[model samples]
Target: MKAPALEQRKLLDLQAADNRIAQLQHTLRTLPQEVRLAELQRDSVAARQEFGGVNGELEDARAEIARVEADIDTVAAREKRDRERLQASSSSKDIQGLEHELASLKVRRSNLEDIELAVMERVEEIEQRLAAITARRDDIATEERLLAAQRDEQRDRVAAQLEVAKSERSAIAGGIGAELLALYERQRERYGVGAALLQGGVSLGTNVALTESDLAQIRAAAPDEVVLDPDGACILVRTEESGL
Candidate 1:
């Protein structure tokens, strides 16, 4: 393909813009906030699960305490009724029996109260744990929000730069002939670079110097000639440094 020397240089500008856009995309995908956000999400799930289990245990403890207190109240009432009947009775047997029954009830009430106390302590511990888990989850949520906002801001900046780069690429492409532009695009897809500077008798794309015959051939060609690498990897755009 034949492209004027100036038009060939435009390929470099287009390639630079393409490279910047690629970098921007890569930056968006691999932002540090993205990794941290993923970790926080996993932690948030685990924290919620722990909070749920602790909350269930706390409820059970409270229910058990209530049941124990009710039993204590019922036992106290029974003891009071038995004492009243014993005071009204004239028989010694009835009085002794009431005394023994009252002692047993006292023991049972003491055991139940002990259990209630234990359950109350357990409830307190569970509440503390729940609170701690809730706080941690909230902290994670806050950090996630902040980081997400920052990530979005960074992405917006990069997006703006990409739009400008795309505009520049479009303008540069418009200046080149259609056939040359098509070929450049194809070669760029294949080799990452569509054209290279011919400098110091070398194709910069391959970093290999041209032989005496090749140099003579390129020198004999027109100023607007498009030279291909010996390996045909890319087009060579001649410059003053071509050492012709």
Candidate 2:
């Protein structure tokens, strides 16, 4: 009976250890810093993508403006050449050809000017968008840095807690008797709850309660009998039984 009582206490200690270990494991698995860091990374990626797209649009607009300006310059040069041809030509047919060429050049210049104005407007819009994107990217980068620091701090705290739990478990295991410890370990392997307090005439830790007949059987055993409740059924521990 003394051995069984001792075994029961040892089982209680084991249960405490298991609960503490589970708590530490849960903290490690669901750290808030980890979730925050993942969100920060996702936001940073989106910001960078937006910034890149804006910059691409800006570059395209500038390229178009340059092309339009070059076309305008070509038309102006053609107009100057045609005007000189008109002043030097004496034949009516040659003058008419020069006039026609000048008319075509003027139309092309007007078209090129309109295109240039549209390209300038597009450039302004792209620059505004790029600036906004850059500012947002910078803000996200700052937030990410802060979140990374927080994550590191959280990891350190969890590590410290795990160490404390491990030391406490070792101390508890060392205080228990060897025979009692062995029995508790065996039961723990088979059942999650190794031992429970018989409280209110009932097992306090088991999912189900022991029946009246089972309690009567336990009471009928010898005064020194070592008994265990297995799956809500009572079992008398044989004196020679080293492990159960």
Q: TM per model?
A: 0.89, 0.76
Query: For model 2, how does the per-residue alpha-carbon lDDT over 215-242 read when each residue is reduced to its tens digit?
Result: 6776666644556774633223332222
Q: Write down the worst ten-residue block by lDDT for model 2.
A: 235-244
Give each model's whole-structure lDDT.
0.85, 0.73
| Candidate with maximal lDDT | 1
Q: Evaluate model 1: give its lDDT.
A: 0.85
In model 1, where do residues sit more than 4 Å from their true spots? 201-217
Q: Please give the RMSD to the true structure for each candidate, in Å.
A: 2.2, 5.4
Tell me the deviation in Å of residue 79 in model 1. Answer: 2.2
Alpha-carbon runs more than 4 Å astray in model 2: 1-7, 83-96, 218-227, 232-244
Per-residue lDDT of 1-244 in model 1, one digit per residue for the tens? Answer: 5778898777767667777777877887787789898999999999989989988998888899889999999999998999899889898999999989999999999998899888889889989999999999999999989999998998888788878878887888888889888887788789877778789999887899889888898898887777777777777887778888
